[model samples]
Target: MTRAKIAKTLLTLPLLSAQLLACQPADGQNPAQPGQPGSLKTLSAPSAAELQSLRSSELPEANTRFALAFFGDLLNETPRENVFISPLSLSIALSMLYQGASGETRQEIADALRYSGLSEAEINAGNLTLRKRLQNSGKGVTVQIANALWGKAGLSFNAGFLSRNQAFYDARLEALDFGSATAVARINQWASDNTNGLIPKVIEEIDPMTILILMNAIYFKGDWSEPFEASQTQERSFYKADGTTLEHPMMQRYDKFRYTNNTDAGFEAVSLPYGEAEETEMILLLPHAGKDLASLRDQLTPENWQSWLSSLRSRDGSVTLPKFKLKTERQLNDTLRRLGMVKAFSEAEAEFDSLLDNSPLKAYVSEVKQDAFIDVNEKGTEAAAVTTITVGATSIQLPQEPFEMVLDRPFLYAIYDRATESLLFMGALNSPEL
Candidate 1:
């Protein structure tokens, strides 16, 4: 009657999806759309007050700290161009990978993920609650998050690892023939379906050494609580980080927004709500006169971010932002290394011993990559990201000139759930790209 024995008994549990991954309606699909794919649980949207409590209680400083560090690293990758990422997606994928690690490998991943003082149980429970609650964070917004495990056909993994993720992450499992010619298409199709077609492909090819594939996809579409009128969108001079001007369509609107002008911190910010409840919001950060995006990026610490968000207040102003659409792709190996996740990626040093039941091929994370897309128009925002850990793993505001804020230069933006206070996405746009 032991837990291990129970898992062992369930080792050959029916595959959650067809062995061939035939594309059809997903299992236990959410009522929202075509790609609900085995959600297993339906979570009700929390009230604004409940969301505030969740943000305060569930969202500890660790994930937020990691999010900021992750963003800073991405900015370093491409200092003066456009870059966007979903920290939530990346964390979920890596966390799923983290479930299989042991010894030094586990320790390193915990450190890299900023889970230093927390137990794995704590992290799992927190992720579960946050993910469940945030799905309905915005009253009129659509936020879908999906996770799946694609194992090499007939592979038997540690039952504990699989069950833990299934319990905490609602991740579905499917057996897949890695050697199948259509393997790539099947995965890409799942990614497309889950992300509402925002990201149609995640992997170009399956490495011969690959045995397992874990994916996390997030799709978000929200209309601004107060949308910018299309009639007011006009060409404006937007200065790039390189000091060149790019004339792009800037959507203009006047409204009272949660605004902050912190001269000492070298940035000004504004918060724009998404749905009627306003539990989900986008925050915009612009470095004022003397500060640039680089300096602003450097200041992206958890402490500074908290200070910035706390300092916001209602202010009357006219806000101008560009109508932009951009896509991003990144290989996270280097970034993970920089963030101190050295052991997991090593073919020899890595110890994902808890992953497979009895495979002699040896398992170590081989790749970690992510693809994300974002479109910010007058209607609101449509964004999606797929973080595929090939064992690899892994906003705002406004206000007028003086009382008017014009994001005619490089700036930062974020989409977040106020209830969980968890950052869903973040980006730096030097110049508007459509």
Candidate 2:
């Protein structure tokens, strides 16, 4: 997963009734009604000590389970494409939404996210810790995470919902007229800016009935700690999943990388570190010849993933990896529905009472979209991803024995944070287009 760029779009429609909720008079007599315009209060930013404490906490096992499960589902659904996704981005956005969910809606999301046993405070704290850690700079590496919320003007939302998201996710909130083109442009501009223009647009058009949009953007750029010389990059035959071979520019480097050969798991893996922090590394998993990528992916359970990580060992190795770039757009609505989140998409049964002041308003998720891009070459790797969960939203490791790891065939790769064990970006390179 070298030199990659990614983006995503999500749209949620909360259908509101024409009747407005009754509220106390505008006079300064009683507290303002929840969701009323100007009634919401912004929560103050967390103190330095609080943020430090959060940073010290590790992501819960439940969060890891949800991430691995979602990755498995995405791989199963898109069996052929060059797939790449940011589980952290999706989780952060969903975690924000979870704060506003109640009853069955909360339970369904909790179940789907594997947050069943964790408290909302714990979930939010974990997300904050990872988000802040990923963005901190070390040597030549740069990882950035951004979040935002856009709401339809005049819509009354629960003040607590707004406050919680702001407090935890550091989301910037804006009120917009959904019918206006300017509003759409502004939102897209934010996406572009956050992703360093790798993703110029995440929203094509805003549905009239749509009342809110939640978004997350992630950007990563890093130079290899021991970069390959450009002169060593040579054209070589690269095998494709479809039994075809094409000439691709292959980068060759002889370096000491954490490597492993897992006979039980059926793949050879190598870890390529970036920058001085060595906190993030790209783990490449090349399945043994005769073993299909699909079958190997099927065995990628949480337990297996952990076992593979634990089995990785340090070894000096010769590496040959192709220079490749991929850009993809995927709709995750169907995949999410298959993952036991059936009620949220239903206009009839979806529950979002915590998000709005009016209990009678019925709303559901209409779409979940993502766009991503990546480019891996001799200098290093660059990747970007944007995830937009529109109410309707939806959204690892290693091996070694490899004294020599040549990724000339189809293989899987993951850009992971060593500190948090977070899979920032992942994909399978079936063919080398560049």
The top-ranked prediction according to TM-score is: 1
lDDT of 1 by residue, 1-434 (tens): 10000000000000111111111222232211112233323566555665455455534578888888888887887787677888877777778888888899889988888988777777887777677786766567888877787766555567777788788777756666677768788888988887788788777777655666777777888989999999999998887767677778889888888888787877778888998998888888877764677878888898888888888888787788888888877777789889989977776677776776544444566667778888889999988887766552114555544457788888888887766777888888777889
TM-score (C-alpha) between model 2 and the true structure: 0.85
Encode model 2's per-residue lDDT on 1-434: one tens digit a residue: 22111111111111111111211112231222223221112233455775666545544456557667777777777665567777666777677777767778778877887777677877887676666666674787888777777776666667788788777777645777678999789877877777788888877778666777777777789889899999999987777777777787888988778777788877877788999988888878888776657866788777887778777777767888888877777777787677667777776677776776643466567766777878788989888777766663210435434376777777878787776677777777776665
True-structure lDDT of candidate 1: 0.71
* Steric overlap count per candidate: 19, 40
Judged by whole-model lDDT over C-alpha atoms, candidate 2 comes out at 0.68
